[model samples]
Target: MTEQRSSPTTSGTTASTGDDGGARTGVAALVLLAACTALAQGLARYSFGPLLLPMREDVIRSYAIGGLLATVHMAGYLVGAVAGVRASARVAPLWLIRTGMAGSVAGLAVLSFSTGSAMVGAGLFLTGMGGALVWLAAPAVAVQVYPCDPGRAIAIIASSMGIGITLGSVVPALVPAVGGWRAVWGIEAVSVLVVLCVSLLLLGSRPQVSARAEESGGWRPDRRWIWTVVAFAAFSFGIGTGMTFFVAALRDGAGWTVRRAGATYSMIGVAMIAGGVIAERLSRSLGRMPVLVAQFVLAAASMFMVATGMGPVVSVAAVIIGTTMSGTAAVVSADLHDRYSPQQMAAAFGLMLIPLGIGQMLGPTAGGWAVDLAGDPFTAFMLCGAVMGAGLLPLVIHGCRRTRRAQTPLITGR
Candidate 1:
């Protein structure tokens, strides 16, 4: 499940090389890829969570319906990922990344033009598909350029997603003073387009992608890699569940105001930042599995704290959990780099996002149900905690097997 970078073609055919110049060029291109991810993920992908309440109120969707909308958005993302995974040969992944970002930009632009439920849903689908494509393509670039240090390269690229999520939250708070919720999409569209154009100009001299892919073997992840992707999907799903509705749950469960409760979400974002930096360093030192298991465990604990009710202790616990869970993007991306062929990079990562969609679909619904039935958040928090804990089991078991195997002796010398 590994592919080498493209070999240097004969004079002027494709201009491939393993020279320092080529590596540097490819790394520069990856910087653009990371920039693209920062733009798409921040504005198009993650902004959904912050918009949930305002959009739901405006469109008159039930809590369950809100869950469905998120599910549908992720469904489109799943399709995009599968599409990336099915490549016949190495095409220029950058082009696909650009096209995806463009589609999301267009979709966001259109989202501002209507309030009809159907239009809104369609816009979200395009947005999801676009972001999925960017995420799929960008990391492939990261791995190719720094094939010798793929994990470090991928961690740098993956960290952009965390940055994006944090920025996405900031957008919502600005929505009111700026214009309206719809205007937020318009602003992001313009910002993304400008960044894309600027990146193309400054980063134009990079080596052609075809050169890189040929070296990396080709554009196909093995069938075996799908299982790992599914596992990551589970990991992402549980994390999303805890995070997606945390602020809303707090406000509802404890009768806190939006301003008062939003801090918890912000703290989660800060934790994500801290966790991301640490995860990258840790993954490099210790490898992916150990780091990933630790993160899942952190997520489980954070969910318990979040569910327990709002107190300083719970808040700290939420920070610990949120940071740990949300920061999985880097470690998982690196894991994909390790477990699959480079060509299959985007598709594999995209496939893992499925469980994330499922978990998010459940979070609000379950959280709402708990609030209703328990008559206090105490019961609901317990339920949320349980869901997160359930999510952690598969991974911990998987980790245990790997650990035991690592400890087991190899056959004696002949």
Candidate 2:
């Protein structure tokens, strides 16, 4: 059998820099990719989750419609994901990053200027599409630029999602001062545009990968990849609900004001940043699957706490949930990076997103229906918990099987 085990330390580059110099350059590259991630994925895609309630009350005017908007947004994500996979093979990765950033600004501009539902849908769809491209390109570039330490580099970039969400959630606090939510979008657009320009200047041309690395980890229809997809999908379903409706849950379920929920959401963002910072370290120390298992279990527990109406615990749970999810994503991204070369990353990662996109697309709608059926967000929260908890078992079993198989030959003296 081929070596199914993933090693984060392997790389395609031949660098001879001093440790300190390499560390410095890696950090700098990480920051650049993180900024790009924050702008493209965070500001562009995640902002919608926190902004959903306000948009519903002020503009959307219905729960079903709001859910529909989220579904549509994710639909666009699916489309963009497919496009990114194909485009990355033919285009410069930096160009795709630049395009994603520019598209986000354009989408936000549309959302800022329009009040119609069609416009909202169109804008959000565009944002989703752009976010997909950003998500695809940023890490691809990061791993390439800092191939010496792909896990840590990818973790730094992935952490930007939390930062972006935190920043977006805070916008409601400025609603009164900025005149309206639309103004917030306008400001974010300007800020992201600036980030986009910076990314273009900093990202430079795409680095060429050695053809050997490109063709090394050929796709194996193994149980491991299948479990990864299943785990990722389940996690996506659980987190997508919280991400899209956590504020609504707080407002409707916990009876907190939207402002209060938004503040709490910011806390989750902080946790996400912390998670990003710690993900690679923890994965390196403890192994990727263990870290992922711990995070997923913790996320389920956190959601359960929220479901039980433990108010004080909700914020704490939010922190753990955010940390685990982001950490899990970081570890998984790094694992994929180890599995595929820069030339093949876009397609591999994009293919992985198929299940994730489907799960995300279904989450909001499913959560909404659960709320409607149970007449409370509590049931939806519980559903999230159950799905996540169930998802962890398969991963644990499969990972153990892989580990045992990897060790069997040595134990048998083969």
TM-score for each predicted model, relative to the true structure: 0.80, 0.89
Candidate number achieving the greatest lDDT relative to the actual structure: 2
State each model's CA lDDT, in order: 0.63, 0.76
Give candidate 2's error at residue 350 in angstroms.
2.2
Candidate 1 lDDT over residue span 57-85, tens digit each: 78736544554565566666766666654
Candidate 2 lDDT by residue in tens digits, 323-348: 97678879877666555555445556
Residue-level error in angstroms, candidate 1, position 305: 1.5
Which regions in candidate 1 have their CA more than 4 angstroms from the true location? 1-28, 87-90, 145-148, 203-205, 211-230, 339-341, 344-385, 410-414
lDDT of 1 at 269: 55
Tell me the deviation in Å of residue 1 in model 1.
16
